[model samples]
Target: MLITLIILVLAAIFFMNGKIRSDLVALCALILLLVFQILTPEEALSGFSNPIVIMMIGLFVVGGAIFQTGLAKMISNKMLKLAGKSELRLFILLMAVTSAIGAFVSNTGTVALLLPIAVSLAASFHMNPSRLLMPIAFASSMGGMMTLIGTPPNLVIQNTLTEAGFQPLEFFSFLPVGLICVGVGTLVLIPLSKYFLSKTGTKEKQRGYKNKSLNDLAAEYQLGDHLFRMHVAPHSPLIGKTAAEADIRNRYDLNILEIRRITVPQSRFFKTISQRTAPNTVLLPDDLLYVMGDFDKVQHFAETYRLELLDTHMPEERSAINRNSLDFYDIGIAEIVLMPTSGLINRTIGESGFRDKYHVNILGIRRKREYILNNLKGEKMHSGDVLLVQGSWNAIGHLSQENSDWVVLGQPLNEAAKVTLDYKAPLAGVIMLLMIMAMVFDFIPIAPVTAIMIAAVLMVLTGCFRNVEAAYKTINWESIVLIAAMLPMSMALEKTGVSEYISNSLVSGLGVYGPIVLLAGIYFTTSLLTMFISNTATAVLLAPIALQSAIQIGTSPYPFLFAVTVGASMCFASPFSTPPNALVMPAGQYTFMDYIKVGLPLQILIGIVMILTLPLLFPF
Candidate 1:
């Protein structure tokens, strides 16, 4: 009893403050549970090896590969164009597409793919992106509940059912209820989405943030006053001044990166010097000087030295401008921005083989403020690091073909790579065949994990992920660690008889209401908890309770199991409910109230559906 209270309190506190990393919090709790003898060490570590856990992790990598290729972007774009006239039609179209994709692929991946597209579509209609983004996210969640592989909850419940001597469910088993949820959910979306939040920005910024957090990675590069980039242009009085007079280094908190004379060619590639160039060197038109230091201090020095009088300019690294190593029959060069949720994050360049396999070459990589060489320095990469890759002409052939894990920062390059532009369509078709064959007539059981892994490599072999190592350089380690550590906590819940106790207590107290109501209560409790804690942890902690409660009430466990699943996945109440929420928080400039206004009603709608509709479909 005491242990339960302590664990619950610890979880509540952790969820309330988003300061610590989820994985770290999970690890701490796991250790605490073990120390208190609440769970064995083996139980704590068991989640790492769970088939479901392994499948999810492996699938994440595959999803990353597809996203990196830019295949999903094209598809979403087409949907936006096709939804021409009506706002309702557009909302339905986006939601339907996301739901369809989520049913077959990863839910989070589906959201990541559609977020920007939804935002773009909303902007086209002159609507606030926040309105549409929440729907896309909600729709993705609803869509995921339709298939066996649609969501982790479905998979968890299915596995639990099988363990209890029930036959395993088919892939589309949840489709029946799934369709109903979509139908009802989509209807609610028209009103909740349109009227709920501020309507000025697009969903792209609402669901995902445009600005990257510098604090997470700036510390890694040691961003002191050395080797900085200060924007200056042509015709400045300081253009011909000596370094000593510019006072940029000694007086200003900085060091000079390089001095360019006429063209900006080699200037983009920084060159640091201890000694200043001779005054007689005569600074030419548009000479860019790179200096590092505090932005404020740099500004002060520029103001005092009148550096702006020379011409300060911003540096642009467009994807189309990035060069490639060799010719891809239909490829082009591009610099792709990696989103934090992308699967390609936290991977190694050598392992991804984007170069050797896909015929693409990485020119440079950037994360927050840390910029590494396109090829070598970024060989060890992390999430949010922009990778400059040269793609073949078929880069824009199809959403799936150009599917990738990175964000397209600008338009695709026209002359970046050898123009196989016409041939690009065929490559896309080939990729489609490969992906479909892998997912459907699986003579080799090509699940999402296998299908995507094979496709990612084939992309390289076929020159899609031109730089094989790029794939390896793109995974998010923090998420992986979190998933790995939480599994054991889930296992311990079942092993320690704690799940039974909690379930029994809750059920006994609610006996007057009966089994289904009791189960619903349990699920709602979990859903509410998830708005604060890690949704994964919520699922892990409550999953056992759901099962045990159903047994205690002598009802079928499937309904109860699914109730918990849906509840755990519905993280619409608070910003902390999901990583996606945080990603878009600043871009929308959303206050906590904004999320509540938008997410609260969606939560209620989903809650009613889960409680009333889910049971009829899954059966107890």
Candidate 2:
């Protein structure tokens, strides 16, 4: 017991320090328990196969499909449109909608999907985005309390009951608690967010480029009149030569933006593929080259090279070319500012090997309020220069992730979100609704976890997500590892007699008053611990103790377990306590004190309500 307590204290210290990842801390604790022979290897490693962990993974994939298909965004936009110039109405609706979605989705996923929408709606209504962002984050957690799969803490409690051979909770067993949580949250947060977050929120930092569309970028760079397409005829001199060997750009004074060719025969769907024009890209007969230059120069180059002009835009064809030529499905454009510390600060565009390294084209350079369009290959890059880059959407997204090279302006993925497969929206909606129905109705006779797994598979099979890798990307592996690593901890505490010791102390200390006082003690302790530890981790550690406490007190364990889950889920006072809270901090320009001011009160009030209400609902 002493050994276990010491390891627990060390884990707690690491968790509070925030220097190490929470998941890594949990894994380290698990390893320590094994090394100390506190647990058998099977006992130590059992958490990886926990059904609760599996369910959480499935839920993440389903939630990601919902977002990827734009079903969530579509619903949010439609509902937000009804607010119609009323800030109060918008606030109420935003909270209600966020909670509703959060009830079924993971709170982190819920907050991420709705964060931008909330910010935009608040701005549209002439209100502070900070006012709505924090509430949305809180509402997502409140919403998670509604269903068995809403959050990991709720699942921890459910798993506890099932493992103890008690009646497991139904899918909607948390509906009432969740409802009250949302209601109380709505009532308390209105005044708190308004007064605390204030009207004049922190202004966003200025960037080199605004959130411009592809057409806007093309126009600003004067690409419309200068861009043209030509076909590589069988007899053309460029048919078998590589781009570098041909030296087309240097000879013809034309830039090859991209090369489009039919990789497969004509019968195959999506057979036509576009590749970025790198130095070694070899030209093939019948290849279509998208180039940018003056129309006369491009025509002269095409004639000289025996190429066929496919779409040479004269003065009258500029608009059509601008609208249709820049197909962003596979190829797209974004602006990236060169970092002062970038290694390519003094290199010419041609010498940087950017096309080979990053698989993109630097179409134009924006330097000192001037746009350089032509002869860009020889242009030397300067620090703080913003380059108009064109490449595959995936390549562009990859560039956004590399902060060491340059900073990508605006949210490129958010812009990609706007171009979601709307055709699959209905399919995704049906799959989601069917999954919900399967879980809600007893006639389906499917286990909740099984149902979630089935839904996740169907989401991938039905093309709700772009691909399997995309679906995998949706799962938060850090949270999964943390929760899975912590599950065995409850068993370790039980094995070491720590849970019994803690429960006995609680019962002896608070039992004289009543079960309600003991329940409040358990609730508040879990709530307080969650302010520093992760809510899921706190719940996993405390649930067995709460159960043992209830069993010892000769009362139903339902209320006590409910208290544990509720207290863990209702964490607010600290920004880093919950993923949703941390997610909105920068976007909302929130400080630690901001959460304390608005969230601390909500946290305390919700705990009081749940402690007073759980025993009545569950019949302790």
TM-score of each: 0.52, 0.61
Q: Per-model C-alpha lDDT, please?
A: 0.57, 0.79
Deviating ranges (above 4 Å) for candidate 1: 1-8, 19-70, 85-88, 106-109, 112-134, 147-149, 152-173, 189-443, 466-474, 495-497, 525-601, 614-620
Model 1: per-residue Cα lDDT over 77-111, one tens digit each: 67767876777778888888888987875665565
Candidate 1 total steric clashes: 74
In terms of lDDT, the best-performing candidate is: 2
Question: Per-residue lDDT for 103 in model 2?
Answer: 91
Native-to-model Cα distance after best TM-score fit, residue 237 in candidate 2, in Å: 19
